[model samples]
Target: MEEFNWLQLLNPEFYILLELGGVKIGLFVVLFIVFAETGLLAGFFLPGDSLLFLAGIYSEGLMNQFSTHNDFLNVTIFALLVSLMGILGNMTSYWFGAKSGGYLYSRQDSFFYKKKYLYQSKEFFEKYGSKAIVFARFLPVVRTFAPVIAGIVEMDKKKFMLYNILGSLLWSFSMIFSGHYLHAFFLNEFGVDLKHYIEYIVIIIVLFTTVPVLWKILKKQAHIEE
Candidate 1:
């Protein structure tokens, strides 16, 4: 057996190929991955933005597996389904937080858990109130834990649902459409296949979403040392 190359984490296309292998699972894997990342703590490490972007790029083909539709319509449908999963995922995390949030805070950190993330999410929730749900959707690790904090705090169910839907829809649609349109724009306008450049795009996205949290953590650690 070969040692796993951690570099593959940068490319979400790998999972779509490695796990589903283009098996016509269509939206199944996309929805599942979205749900897992937002809904399940273990899914924090799984690809999120990139997967949605890749889905956008390949939205037509992915959707064709189930039902045929116009290109834009196909991407729209894909985005909607992805949004649904994201919403559900957030709800799951919220429920877990409501049920076991106290336990989570006291639980020791391990390979699968990080209390700092939970705390950071708590900060965001405190600062932004309910809006953190929408704002955190754009952040990587924070997105996973924000709703959990909300649950732990016992935010109103109706309020959580409202922001969850709005956030999920905005996040999924923006990412997917950006990929879809950009992929098409490059190909149709410049004879470029955007998939060839997806790795770099994913890198940009990771940095874009991950930087602030990293900065905050580093800054907080520095403050503690001082």
Candidate 2:
């Protein structure tokens, strides 16, 4: 009998997404995270971008562990599955909004349900219209809430579906494939394994995703000062 390493589970690098691969349940974990992050308001704080990228990097090792060959094909399949998860998650969020958004309108502000946040999403949807769906995929909190706002406003379902699919494909494919290729590039060109530097890579990805939000806020403040 062996003692369980609880500390390993607590380590940031030991992300559940990576751990799932070891247990041969990576696909299920990835899909569930994607769905929760996009579909459930409570999931707003999930590390979506970093998780997806890490998944791509670890996926190759996972496949090899299972005696799989043809890295390209495996990675392609993985990317597609992640994309579908994102698309389905947004659709689920939209449906929930359509069914229950009315309740939110009458409710007062609370820790989780802030009228200001909803209003901000509404303003974003109005300013960008359908394009917001595609653009929001690149933004953090906005990505999670854009579909909900669209549903609340009753945007045309047909148009919403088109943008939702496009956004999900763009977001998921970009993150996952970039991780896959970059891992290979580092190993081949620099003779360094990506796993050794994954923490720094995750930090970079976090900053990349968050800089836009910070810039927007700074710009808004500057305008207010003017």
Candidate 3:
């Protein structure tokens, strides 16, 4: 159980160990994870938001533990690299979607395919056209299927790629960098532990995004109900 618990903090642990062991090693792991999650469809489940957030928090810890110069500079570089990886990763997914097209989505039995999400993704593509790619990026489960649906529907490759990359960057980078900067600011200002608030911070961000979208949806619902 202890080993299991420790394993969950693997990225943070790696970051710390790498900083102590060598900066190059630490940076590489971070980049790899970022790219994998953003690009690989199978990697959609990986903890991208949390990893970036933790990376930001860990940056502060690394500064205190080591007499490192330019902590902010280092953190910013880390953030940018991860953000770029995220963009690149989703692009790969988009191309995969383009390449796979209808053939990939035809298999209902594939483990990654879920009836509910596929249906929803279908509805989204039918309703929103190119914008669904953008909107779906912020959704947890839906984001996974959005690209797949785009591929299945044979959405224009150039347009889908543009929106897919934009959405990926906006969603992944914004959450991560926000968490990092917030952690840095709060710690500097209050000298209190912000770790306890991580869940709330994430929830707040999810709601901050989801609520307004929901409101618009509800409003549309009520109009139809009338």
Candidate with the greatest lDDT versus the true structure? 1
Report the C-alpha lDDT of model 2 over 1-226, residue by residue, as the tens digit: 3455866432334553344323666556667777877777634456688878887888775455543478888877777887888898899889988888677667797654566556666777898999999988887777888888888889899999999999999988888888888888999998999888877987888899889777877798799999
Q: Give the CA lDDT, 0 to 100, for residue 192 in model 3.
A: 68
Residues 6-41 of candidate 1 have per-residue lDDT tens digits of 887656886555534426664676788899986888
Evaluated at residue 118, the lDDT of candidate 3 is 57
Which TM-score value belongs to model 3?
0.67
Q: Name the lDDT of candidate 2.
A: 0.77
After TM-score superposition, what is the CA distance of residue 173 in candidate 2 from its true location, in Å?
0.8
Q: Rate the local accuracy (lDDT) of all candidates.
A: 0.85, 0.77, 0.62
Model 3 ranges with Cα > 4 A deviation: 5-30, 60-72, 108-115, 196-226
Which pairs clash in the backbone of model 3? Answer: 38-89, 38-90, 39-89
Q: For each candidate, C-alpha RMSD in Å?
A: 2.4, 3.4, 5.2
Best by TM-score: 1
lDDT of 3 by residue, 64-181 (tens): 4343467667666556666677667666766776677665546675554455555655676678889888887676545666776777667787898788778766765676567677
Cα deviation at 162, candidate 3, in Å, is 2.8
After superposition, the stretches of candidate 1 with alpha carbons farther than 4 Å from their true spots are 1-10, 18-22
